[model samples]
Target: MAGYGDDAGFQQWASENGYDVPSGTVAAARQRGSSYIDAVYGERFPGEPAGGIEQDRSWPRVNATDKWGNAIAVDAVPARVIHASYHAALQELQSLGSLEPVVVAAERVKREKVGPLETEYMDGVEGQDALAASTPLLAAVEGLLEPLLTPVGGFPAMMVV
Candidate 1:
């Protein structure tokens, strides 16, 4: 199996075999093999700005490898873990009926305009122009999040928060 720290070797092998690896492929390989690099290297390489590459000096670097023998600097797994945890928490909050009120309020506020000011300003201009631009995004977010607040085998939970 190709372990970490094999990027250069992999690149060389790929080149010798007449394969053209793209930049994205290199980035993906680096991401996947980041853990392996962390295991080998002491979690960081020194900052060398001579090449004009903007390195995050504060973040520790891992010596990741690929199927070949190329090495890369990568962030440690703790960052990924923390990010995933935050997303999961947000998902759980959505599942627990936390975001429904905000959506309902937004819809209600848009619906309750009474005069030309409300219609022209809110609906005609802001709603039709500015807010309309975001309608697709809003719909997508609602579609993705609404189910989380819906009870299984029942109607969607009413707006409470």
Candidate 2:
């Protein structure tokens, strides 16, 4: 992701969390972790937290507070888009376990879990088989983001009856 963080930021986070990760791997992991977010919630543009204005994609900067009350402000686009709140964005960068299962599942088999590209396995490798266990991992990632992603999709009394 573009503005998820820099090498220094990732290192600082890793150090604070007692985890060791390479700077280059930080970018890759962010990309993959954000990919999972996309799969679950679809693409979240800049205006998502700013007010849900779909057309205002060119904001000089956007700011949104995450569940932890941390301020999330950005002026540029990461390769992957943030979910509006800077904390959620940072969460994606901070959690490698969030992406590990996804990467493993993808490597194991070619399939779409949620918002993934609908890819069919056509490699035609006679007896090739592998285990793709990602649901549990994806659930773990979702749990990490639970407080940030609440039920905001619709009203409780939308019944047409």
* Best-performing candidate as measured by lDDT: 2
Displacement of residue 48 (Cα, Å) in model 2 is: 3.0
The TM-score values for the models, in the order shown, are 0.18, 0.38
On residues 91-158, what C-alpha lDDT tens digit does candidate 1 reach at each position?
32234322222223245344445565454223323324332222211222234233222132322222
Top-scoring candidate (TM-score)? 2
Off by over 4 Å in 2: 1-3, 42-144, 152-161
* lDDT at position 92, candidate 1: 27
For residues 27-56, what per-residue lDDT tens digits would candidate 2 score against the true structure? Answer: 665455445454444332223433244523
Worst 10 residues of 2 by lDDT: 152-161
Residue 89: error of model 2 in Å?
A: 11
Angstrom error at residue 6, model 2: 2.8
